[model samples]
Target: MSAQAHPPVVLYDTTLRDGSQSEDVLFSAEDKLRIAKRLDALGLDYIEGGWPGANPKDDDFFRQAKQLKLQKSRITAFGSTRRAGSKVEEDQVIKGLLGSGAQVITVFGKSWDLHVSRALGIPLAQNLELIFDTIRYLKRHVDEVFYDAEHFFDGYRRNPEYARQTLQAAYEGGADALVLCDTNGGTMVEDLRRMIGEVTDLGAPLGIHCHNDCELAVANSLAAVEAGVTHIQGTINGIGERCGNANLISIIPNLKFKMQRSLTLDDEDLTQLTAVSRFVNEMANRPTQKNQPYVGVSAFAHKGGIHVSAVLKDASTYEHISPDLVGNQQRVLVSEQAGRSNLIYKLEELGIEGVDAKDPRLTELLLDVKELEHQGYQFDGADASFQLRVWKALGELPNYFELLGFRVIDERRVRKDGQHPMGAEATVKMRVAGESVHLVAEGAGPVDALHKALSKALRRDYPMVTELKLEDFKVRILGNRKGTEATVRVLIEWYDGRCRWGTVGVSDHIIAASYDAMVEAVKYKLFKDKVKPV
Candidate 1:
């Protein structure tokens, strides 16, 4: 199963267009341009910018995209066919596509007979005219024009002859590719494969665009490829309307490794896949799906004792491929389920040297970890906290500072306008270099005030602490049967410019948990910098 055995699949990314249709996903024109550059760097064949004339932002994106001069990817515009009974030249959708300033344009038209009658309120024969006229007109102006036979699978099933006629209309109009779309995402893989096989003799290159409502977009896309479709259309992380579009992130590795298909991106370029996925998530203001296949953090993470032992011996025992191929690394998670092998691997990964695996202290530390996990502590996402525990167990932890006491007070004040605003104040007392230091600070909340007060007390002796920045905070309640009395776990992420780390604390009190997590975050920063005890 060599890659050369199958024809190359072109990677068409629609993260800016189809992906934006997702709920809560709103990309500014600037965000689209930035993502386009990232997609270009990842070596995609086409980057669908967005629908010009739909909004000011999309129009602005196209105007700016022309200046990007992307190295590898061509900026593409997406829109619909001309409206019924309208001249192609007078159609605003068609006009927008021409003005988009894109080298390539993709136009989706009614392929299903039901959609032609109900959605567009037009005759099926006239819908074919729209598909043909739209692509034919655009092909004369653009370097390439693609026809998206929207709902082609449903259309083929309802009226097979009419569906083939729609494709033929686009082909007669000189479309570079007739892309079959599983727009509803309900088509089974076998049906899609058979239908695609029926259309290969249409004398035009074929492509596939699938959604994930059935959680089958990736599978269906692969099946289409196996049936001889060449072009693959998808978005990063599979974000789109409803469930999402097909995920190019997952599709690429499967195509190159499993399907034995050639790709324009060399092996080196493919390593950027994880980065591209995360960048899109960041720009979209969405959390990374840790369980996403191939590029997710948990994709290659081994958790159970047996899995960790086997993976350490030979990754192939559990993992299907080397994670590094996609720029992701294997992670061995430590939990109550961990064995000695898991602890040793984590210690080595943390760069804690000289601790013998057979040391009696190692057993003590493992027991402590199991007890703590039973008390609602999770070390998998809090590497800094786990490393600190290891150092404390080995009696190698440096005392950066000693906390003396802390107090927080929340108050509500009413203004003359009869509006009440709440505020919080904190007082912190600590010892550094045998000198007592005290500080008070005010913030919008108790945890924020506590953080300010602590930082204020430490800034004089350890000015480098000024570089520490809190990045994210998460809180989870364990055993919610107790309601407000439930033990809560707080996780805080910190960045000091050089690297990022997470620390965790668990307590029945939310404020206590947050303060403890904050303390660990600062301690980890000082420990990593190798600062001497003040």
Candidate 2:
């Protein structure tokens, strides 16, 4: 079907609702409001706020969400059907949804005969009444009512007749959309496509909600759309219970760019895909997957020499789509496996100009990278250190400060409470602007003490050095067999208000490795900001 002929697929985000069920994820009410506003900016059709009566956090979210001014998305309040044998008007769940002040209401009810009988301990016919009553009652108060048929796929496989009857009840009760949910997330794509077709005769607009247990959530969601469903529900970055919900981050681009399906998201909103994905992860305090499809850091990164060479000439040779289309950029990584093309591409990316690819110095620089990587120096994660090497190779590196010597003393003492407390002190000597300076500092640990001492020694001549703050420090043992004596590689990430950069150092002594990485971080900041010596 032509893109214009088919209706634009509605984007429903449940990150605030289902996504909070993920392991160790706790989004404060403030976090949900912020996420809702961001999703609204990204042009989502519906944002599922959460179940208002389920907990105090969601309750607070709904209370504060009243003040949020969203431009494009409708806030949805989710809840379950009224309890068995209870009046829909009197049910607390129903009352909570009515009081949530959301623009839409979505209620899920049992579709599986097993859940109706075993879980709810209610007859199949009574369960249908509950589904019909909850959606019917909510429809009177709200303009839109989306009915979620929980466990519909498995229920359909077990008792096809009962699943259809459940959906029919919701449709007859005036639901605007009937959402078929794969609660267990185990449905095969072929089975989903075939079953979804059978239910279309009901004449209700269909939606698809999927989980990722079998890792087919995205695939199954797309299959449903191809089967003529218009509404697609998912979470940002696919975070939810068990595996996760379907990832809209992957689904959005696939629908817009690959499957040629029209989406409610505009072309401009498509560009915010990566930023939104990362923002959700940040709020959840979860580590981002660097290899995640379109939004990952490694999605467009080329590591192989031949691949980099081809991509440098024409990106389409190795890329499936322009990374710019998703607000990402292609990267060439330098490593022991790097060829001349990798070096040239990386140097150009770092904005270091005037070096010819055929220059003899270029060959030497490539060999130096290989030799250093062989010694446990990885340039891929330490771009700042690699840029420094490029400057030194070009003979344009200036010495802003000279490290003369340093000493560290660590001591442990028993407190009155019988707790052992350790203290560390560092003394650093350096030459700055042709003057010798010595400073002593104490810190929580040896690395912190050294960083403080170095800052004190350099801050006189290089005042901007105060801007550099060590954000992260990681140490990896290159040779595990030697245990404590093994060579360690230290990577230090520094933030100087504007941005963050990483530098790497390798040595047998942990303190020396840390000090070297710290020095490289300072040097990179000085060079990049073009701070001249006093």
Candidate 3:
């Protein structure tokens, strides 16, 4: 069939209502308001705040949102249709919608015959009546009313005529829009397309809501769009019950840039999509998905030799879209799998360039680093300090400071015959700037002794060291088949109040690796301070 001549697509974000159902996601009423304001800034067409009658927090959210002057998006209150055998005028849920002060009201009614008979314990006829009466009542109260036919796709597959009748009920009841929901998240893409076509043939403004049980939520939403649906409903990060609702984070750009659909925002604002996606993830206290379609951190990162080389020639060779188009910067990851091009790219990012494409030494160094990385050293995540070490090893780095010598001593005594126990003591000495600094301290362990001694020695020359501390320390055994003879790799993450950096060290002895990582951490902090004037 020829594509229907539909108006520009509208994005209805359910991040607050549906997204909160995500496992481990529970946003307070205040957080909901904060996210609502941010969603408004991102130019969402509609925001489904929450089910106001379902909980006290949602009620408070509606009350709070009424005070804000959101210019672009309308606040939508979500709820279920009137209960079976209840008049719309008497249903408490319908009354709550009337008092919510939302211009748009979204209510879900059962479309699946199974849900009608089993879940709601009502006859199919009463289910259709419930949908009709609820929509008609909400239409009288609000200018815009959307009827979410929950399980519309599954219902269509099971009882196509009954599902169509439910849609007919909402259409006849004056629903401004009808959203077909894949409530179980089990519908296939081809079925979704055909079903959406069937509904569009019924002559109502169509919308699509899908969950990610089969990991096809984004594809299903897009398929519906391809089938003449005008409204797309989903959460930001595919966050919802079970798997999640369709991720608008993946959908918006696909629609705007790929399908050539308009999103009611200008191109300039569209560039902020990636940033907005990250901002929402941050507010939700969840790590953004690394491989998320349009805006993930690794979406545009290249590591393989062939992929990086091709991407350098033309990003379209490997990337679906330019990173800059979505306000995301491209990255080259360095690991055992990386090639010379990846190293060169990383070195250039660090403002160092001496190796050439055909340099024999470049290949030798790459192979050596890769061999080392295969043993658990990740230089990609620690590129700053890794590059510094590479330059130092190549005799290209200027020596700003050199470690003359260092030592640590610990003494402990135990009481005997009721005598008091003598305290333990540790001492460390290091020479810097032609001056020798020595400090004696007590610690419960060798690692603590080393940390205290080093900090004491460096405090005079680097006062900022006081602000730095180890955030995380992880030790992994490399070549475990070698047993106790295996090498250990240590990763230390340091936070210096403003920013964080990671450093790595590998050695047969764990203490040695720890000390090496410690030295790199201090040097990295100093280097950053010298270069950035912080």
Candidate 4:
């Protein structure tokens, strides 16, 4: 069916509810408000804020969300259907949903025959009654009531009649929509298509809520859409319980561009896709996947010599879709595997000209860098710092600072109690902007002392240094057999309030490697500030 013939597909976002189940994820009430507003702005039909009565954090969210008026999306309060024996008005969960002040309410009801008899300790008939009464009662308070038929796919296969009966109960009780959930996330596409077709034949407005355990959540959701389901429930980045929920990131593009469906939000401005994806990852404090479909850092990156050469001729030769189509720019990765074409691309991006791709000296330099990488220097992950280092090595960089000779000393004294080492001291000397500075600082470690000294020196020129803090520091040994003789690689991540960047350093000495990375981190901040001006 054509998109114009059908109603606009409703988007139910569960980032606030199910997304919190991702491992090590905890969002403060303030963060939830921020994400909720963004989702609302994106034109989602429903925002599942969480189970307010179950936790203080969700309760706070409902209370706080009441003060703000979201123009597009209806905030939804999610909970399970009332218990078999309890009245909907008497159940704490139903009471919480009523008090949440959400325009819509979603309640999950048992659909699998095994769950009804074994999990809830109720007969098939009582389970159906619970589903009916819960929806009937909720319809009284909320304008829109959605029933989540949990494990509907598995339950339908096990006992098709009982699953249909459960849905029948919700339909008879005045539910606005029935969401068929792939709770186990193990259903196949063909089966989901057939099952959704069966459910849609029941004559209620149907929605698909899928999880990614079998890695077919997106496919199954699409299948349901083809089978005439109008609503898609998912989370950004597919973050949720177990594997994750279906990813709206992947689904949104597919529906809008490929399937020719009309999205509730604008699809013409595709550039916002990457920005929105990155913004969500940053707010969640989760690292963006480097190879994640359209928005990943490496999604459009060309590294192979053959691929780069072909792309230089026609981007469509290697790219399935234009990078600009998704608001992402093409990146040519530099490595030992990269060719002269890749080098030229990198240089052009750096705004450096007059260097021929076939220059003998440039070719020799490229070979040397590749040899270094073959020995364990990774440039891709540290492009910003690597670019600066390359510019300095080529004598093309502007001279901003210099480092003077320095010494680190540690003294230990024997005590009557048989103590061996007492403490250590670190001293640093550096010349920046042609001015010499010397400072002594004590730290738990030599690397910490070096960071403190560098910060002290750069404080005068860059007042933004205070906002820059190291988010991560890692050291990896390049050679395993040499033990103490092995070279160490250090990576440091720095962040201001608005943005974050990473840099790397390598040396035989651990302290020296850390110092190198720290210097690059500072320089990167300064360079970006001067160029970008936030």
Candidate 5:
């Protein structure tokens, strides 16, 4: 059905509620408010704020959220349906939901007879009463109430009649939306399609929530949408309890562009998809997956000669959709497996013009890159290092600074003062412009002390160094060599507010490797600013 024929698909985000169930994905009350506002700005229909009274954090989140002026999305207070024997008015969870000051409330109730009997240890009939009375009761207090039929797919398959009865309770109770959930996330798309058809008479707007255990959450959600379900409930990047919820990042564009279904996200909001995805991943302290469908770093990256050549001529030649459609860009990656087109595309992307594809420097650069990669210097994740290599090949970069020498000392002692103390001291000597600068500093660790001393020395000559800061540092032990002989690979990520880049270094000594990566980071900063070393 066309979007004009049906209502725009409602986008319900449970990131603060269901997403927090994910392992290690806790968001403070402040984080929840921030994300809620962002999701609202993204044109979402509902933001499930978390279970009030379930925890102090969620309670405080609702409190703070009420104080903010949300523009579009409704902040939903989530809770479980009232207990089997408890009166809805006497339920503290229901009271908390009312007090949450949210315009909407969502509660999950047992849909599967197995869950009713095994988990709640309640009779099937009593579970239906919980689903009915809880939503019916909340409908009086809240502007909108959504009923979540937990494990609806599995329950429907196990006992189709009982599942429909549970949904019937929700429909009779006046739930604005009846959400079918794939709690186990194992239901196939065809089965979901079939089940959706069976539940059409439940008497509420249908929604779908899915987990990603079988890696079919996004597909299953889409299947439900195709079968006439209008609400799509999921989390950003699919981060949630088990595998995760369906990925809204993948689903939004899929519905808007591919299926031709209307969604809450407008053109501007759609363009911010990649940025919003990265922002959420950053808040979760998770690495953004480079291959994550539309928004990933490698989503539209091309490396092969034929692919790069065709892509450069007409991106539609190999790309299923324009990268910018989802706020992602086409990338030409240069590696040992790449061809002349890769070099040309990359150089042009970097704004290095006037170089022919067959230029000898291009061959030299590719050869050097392949040899370095063979030596364990990964340029793929180290974009700054790759840029430095490009400048070196193009003969445009100059030595910005020279590291004369450095010494690190680690000392530990028990003093007469009855104190056991440990400390690290680093001395750095570097030549900037035409003068030598030396600095010494102490830190909790050798790397920290070295970083301090380096910063101290560089800030005097290159005041712009103040803006350059290391965002992340990683060290990997490479090879089968034993003890100190093992190769140390250090990768450092640097950011100057306006941009961020990564560099890598490999050496036998950890400190040496770190220093090499640190130097590359500084060089990248200078290179971007059009500065060169004397």
Candidate 6:
């Protein structure tokens, strides 16, 4: 087929609707509004807000969506087909969907005969009426109506004749598009592609909605598009029930750059793919997966000497595509795996002078980094500590401050709110500017109390430390050691007004690991200021 053979594929983002089905994913009204704006900015064709009348939160989202003016993407309200044996006019769910201020309405119906008989407990004929009347009635009220044929691939496999009839009913009812849903999400890519090829002439524009149970959601979605499906439904970062739905972050770039097909997002919008992925992950408060396919932190990070050397020569050697094309940058990671050339490359990137490319000292530096990593000190996620290591390697690290001693007291007590909260108090003493400063503070946890006490002691001397706020704190257990005996690796992310950096520490005690990382964070801030004298 030629490039001009098919129209542009419409990207339908269900981050609010199906994405909420993901465990631990809860979006407030403000979060939904923010994500909707981001989808609009990404130039997605459709943004499916949560189903109306499902809950008060979804109701609030639709009410709030009315105030926001999206420039490009249209807001779509989702619902199911009219209830079994109920009038489309009297169906409260259908009415709720039309009352929703969205320009488009999507109603899912039973495509599989087993679902019609077992799930709905209704005959196949009545289910067909439900699909037709629901789409037909809503089409009059909404500008566009999409019918999601739930369990389409499985249904087609079981009873192809019955599945075609259901789709034909939707087509006759005037649905603008028919989205084939892999609700159970277990269909193979080849099976789904063959099924879609047979169903393309059902008298409506075709679409694909997939789940990642088999880890083939993206592949299956592309197969459908190749078979002339025009609409693709997915969630950002593939957040959904069970495994996940298709990940738009992967599909968008694949369609535009790899498949060389037309999509709603242009080249510039495509570059923001990583930023959008991180933005959504941040809003959900989920840790960004470093090893994810396209937009992950480690997607473009090169650690081995062979890979880094070749990448420096020509990035296309090991990389499939330019990382910057998807808003990610190449990283040269340092470890025992790195060669002398890698160390030289890193020294040049860091702008550190006097380090010869062939310096024998680099071998010791490399060994130290590898040993630290072996002890659960992860330098890849900790830029601040890594900088400290580089300075120590050159024997030029400054003595920022002298820690005298620190103590922490944690107690469990019932508060006035009738809640037994952990009461934590910490004392920190440090010598700064030739003066001994002692401070005490209390917090909800040992780490918080320690940070507060340390900040209080250094407030007058290092006023910039107050601007450094811990953004995220994570602890990973190392090796087979279990429970309290386990060695812990603590990674702390800190952000000043302009810049963000990570620090890491490792120890058998969690609190000790946290304190070590926190100290690195403070020292790095002070070091940057002394270098620039700002």
Clashing pairs in 5: 399-533, 400-533
317-346, model 1: which lDDT tens digit per residue? 999999999999999998999988899899
lDDT of each: 0.92, 0.93, 0.83, 0.83, 0.88, 0.89
Q: TM-score for model 3?
A: 0.87
lDDT for predicted candidate 4 compared with the true structure: 0.83
Q: Model 2 residue 67 lDDT?
A: 92
**Best model per lDDT:** 2
Report the number of clashing residue pairs per model.
0, 0, 0, 0, 2, 0
Model 3 regions lying over 4 Å from their true place: 1-6, 353-355, 358-368, 393-429, 434-453, 469-478, 482-492, 507-515, 531-534
Between prediction 3 and prediction 4, the one with superior lDDT is: 4
Off by over 4 Å in 1: 435-438
- lDDT per residue as tens, model 4, 1-534: 677876788889999999988885788889889988877767777899999799999999999999878988888999999887888789998999999998799999999999988999988999988889999998988899999999999999999999999999999999998999999999999999998887777899999999999999999998899898888999988888899999998888788777877678775445567777787788889989999888888999999988999999999899888877777889998888988888778888888777877777577768877886876677777776767765755665565567775556556768899977644456778776667888777654677666766777667766766677778887889977588999988888778887777777788987787887777877777676663222
Name the better of 1 and 3 by lDDT: 1
TM-score of 5: 0.92
lDDT of 2 by residue, 280-393 (tens): 999999988999999999999998899988998899999999988888878889988888899988888877666788998889889999999999999777999999988888
Q: Count steric clashes of candidate 5.
A: 2
Worst 10 residues of 5 by lDDT: 372-381
Instruction: For candidate 6, give the lDDT of residue 45.
Output: 91
